[model samples]
Target: MSSPAPFSRYEFMIAWRYLRARRAEGGVSVMTWISLIGIALGVMALIATLAVRAGFRAEFVDTILGANAHTTVYMAPQRVENEFTDDVYVVPGRIQDYDAMAAKLAELPGVERTTPIVRGQVMATANDSSNVAEIFGVSLDALKAMPRIVDPQTSQGSVEDFDKGVAIGAGIQRELNLNIGDKIKLIAPEGAKTPVGTTPRVKSYEVVYVFSAGRYDIDRTRIYMPLAEAQDYFNRENVADEIEVFVTDPEKVDDWTLPLLEAAGDGAQVWNWRDASGSFLSALDMEDDVMFVILSVLVLIASMNITSGLIMLVKNKGGDIGILRTMGLTEGAVLRVFFLCGAFTGIIGTIAGVILGVLLALNVDGIMAALNALTNGGAWQPEVRGIYRLPAELRAWDIFRAIGLSLALSFIVTIFPARRAARMNPVEALRYE
Candidate 1:
């Protein structure tokens, strides 16, 4: 007769019979249940952690890129020599002919759009409230195109009146108690120049728009004004402080540094978002690695239950194994049967974990909202976390990794008990009975 194929139907049937046996009859049913639950919980926890990490990182980076420039080109500082005193002084550079330069930079590879910005710090006061604001001078067209500023989900008011007034962050509006069409006074410390000295420039503009960038700091402190108004307010005429460059891909910004510099020409310096936010991104990456290591240990611990369960099953079935071996069962068949029992538990557990994790990830926002409501809106603080909401993004690779790790551990731990069952002496096992 031909030898039976590996892992035949009989092996699976025997494994199922052993798994279903009653605990009172020397069965390991309780241990099997415990092992399955443990593995499932561990896998679920790992998947959830990974999803949160990914979502947090993505949201953080998205806010950064959307609300700010991917890269900025500024005029390099120039050294000026005093002819009479024979002394040298460094003067802050200004980007004159910025329109032409912005147009040139927009043509470079991977360059999305370029906007000339006049930036300044000023005190905003309205309705007996005052706050410091970092103002960016941008064209109405650019303001409308900006991702965070024009986002319908978070922004209120209209940019049509932007040229006639100013757009303020939601935080600033709340602090100053200002609303659309309300006048807000901006006090610039370095203002008009007179014969005697300079005076602080104080001007009032109507709040034409309000926006939320989904970031606490940005939404709290940023303001957008018309380019002409900002230029006049900041005493910059026919010049720009810097050119903000958006790119096709913010992550590959470094690759465009040289090209941007070349396009910007001499007396220009380049700075990218990475230069400003690299340390924070690195910290996030470190946190992700640490979390994965910690959760992997949890999975390993849970898989230990599988080893214990399989060992008990091996002991309880010793008599059955001796009879089967005497009848005609091969040692390999005995090992396969026991291995199938543990593998089946792991497979089912991993599938259940994946389902649970995906469901949780998909509903994370609703769950967080419910939790926050239960805690009286204390569960999530945007100011503390720097994000408006808790985010959870389920990635296919993360789920696959969780499944792989759990199954690998289960198989490894099951080996020892399986080998022990296969090598048992039929005569000795029968003698004990």
Candidate 2:
């Protein structure tokens, strides 16, 4: 009969030391090397991929957040105006008590900035360049926020001029050879077509500032114009696309969304960042999910090497196992000894993997920069999954997960061979000599 070792700190330390001693035999092998490298690759892939996802998500959120507010309120789509629903898709309308909406929302718990936006698409053209662009009209008072998004030197106009002038993106300026004083002609569907013909319409405005927001799409395709001018241009001064509000904390977005919607009652629909970016966020999530599964497969494949190595160890240690069984060692203790030996591969491999992954995450930017220098800066940019730096941001949570999964996988690989060693008969095992 075999006695079970007490599940104590001393017992675990004994297990650790015994396995570490013969580490050359138990802890180190070609297979162990393969396992460690495989694990490191997987963990590094995970950290880098997750970091990219976070960065991309952050950039996208910032793009929307800086230009707009945290939540947007809109008129429910005509299809379901009377029936209430929490779904975010809705039509445009100017809110009632416009100032009252802001004042009341500001009073709510955790609310920050409140603004409104009127959005439309317009086509821009210059002597040599022509492109479609997005236009946003905001209150003049919000112009104070320009520095939050753009370099202060890039544009001279403030949101105050939004009613009197407009701002063009830097890319638009570059493409069209435009300056602060250049005028742009906006071509949009001005009004519904009548039996007479399409309503004759073309609106033009002078560019007041050329602002750069650091995103290619925005820099190339967005223009901020005055609200009254846009309202006059679109002939829909009666409505706004959405009311923008900022919160004290971005993490409570969903929480505030529901209560704000509830407070607004059935008059409008509410949307958070996820609602504004639903498809984009979903695509990001799917990418993360795909990466995890794919990388986990690599780790699983590496585990096969651990399994084979353990089986070999059991075979090679038969005489040792037999002699130990003939002594005071019980089968249970013998099994633990072999199991620890096999498990040592996983433990050491995991430690190596964690170290390597952290180093990669922390210094990935330098590595990419070095690669770029080697290539002489020829059209190389870090993957723009979101942030400028190819990031591998790891939190304690991620570290814990990586370590847990790796160790668990290592322990699992030890079971079969360990059982075989435990079940061996001493006489038969020794007769092989």
Candidate 3:
């Protein structure tokens, strides 16, 4: 007959009518707006938090890569107990033919460059103050190739100049109150044992350059010296403790891992920056996941508002529902009307929140800079409160998951109220009217 009136169209029209209805006409109510706002706020929190976590991870990875090599070909530590002192020595396995090994690694695809490095820790003394600093004995050419490792304008001298002396981090200079020409002593304890109960291998170096590595730890406690000079200081002449491998993509370190290790042969072990900082990275990921779950409670709480609003709407529309049932509206159709109403609130809220969150994430850096400037009354320090500003990376999947989960929960919450409305007794519902 009349081609069973378009049920879907009828449901949508009825749902929209109810949504747009005035308070007197039983249209969308105050509860619905409250529920919508709640959902919106929750979704916004989720997206923003996820973006920030992503951003922090990305920034950390880049910083690590900048300060360290993408991959290091080194000997695994052969832990040896020092008979002279309580200190335990972790001597790295050495690469005697590092030059040839580096050349071989450089031939591999994706390898940007390879540099032999003498890496160790040394006690640095300046201004009569002493602190242990991480040291990298690297070629001046290699140091020059590293981005942000040296800033010539601010630096007192060039990388080549470091061969005659040493380049220290700005933090070191500030802490020791030493100028470019001041002398700093670097003492390596793993030196030759003399009659004087193991004399510390020590060298006095002129601070020829000052570098700002953009990382608080690096700026405070990292030093670079000419490779040959470092070798002499550590008593490892004509040998390198490791071969630092730089690659095009630090994130894809695995791709080059096996190939590089294979080229280096059996004695050398290849590891990436991630391996060196696995614990920290794992903790970051766990923190992000925990935050997501904790923040999701906000969305769940918001969905309860949808349930409350739907129940109230059904109660107010009992008479209209009675009439629809009497006119042969199926239970499923009746359920869908209220379902659509609640779903509409969730969909709108999710969309709005996602847009707001993304916009905030994209400009978070600038926002933080302005806020910091206002508070500090000056330029924003990159490392204020021991943290850089929120570095946000918004991902499509994160947004999609947030919206999907919110909408699904919203849809699920509406079912109870919709079902109750659909099952109402028409006679009793109409008797009151």
Return the top candidate by TM-score: 1
The lDDT of each candidate is: 0.90, 0.69, 0.84
lDDT of 1 by residue, 1-433 (tens): 9879999999999999888968485448878888888888888888988998899989999898888999999998899999999999997789999999999999987888999999999999988889999999999888887788889887778878889899999999889988889999999998999998999999999898999988999988999999998999999989999999998988999998999889888978999999998999899999988998898898788778878889888888889999999999999999999999999888888888788878888888899999999998899988899998989989989988899998998888888899999999999889989
lDDT by residue (tens digit), candidate 3, 312-398? 788888999999989988788899899999999999988888988898889988988888778883454655522355689999999
Clashing pairs in 2: 56-386, 143-159, 162-226
What order do candidates take by lDDT, descending?
1, 3, 2
Q: lDDT (0-100) at residue 286 of candidate 3?
A: 96
True-structure RMSD, every candidate: 1.7, 6.4, 4.2
Better of 1 and 2 by lDDT: 1
Model 1 backbone overlap count? 0
* TM-score to native of every candidate shown: 0.96, 0.77, 0.85
- Report the CA-based lDDT of candidate 3 relative to the real structure: 0.84
Sorting all predicted structures by TM-score, with the top scorer first, yields: 1, 3, 2
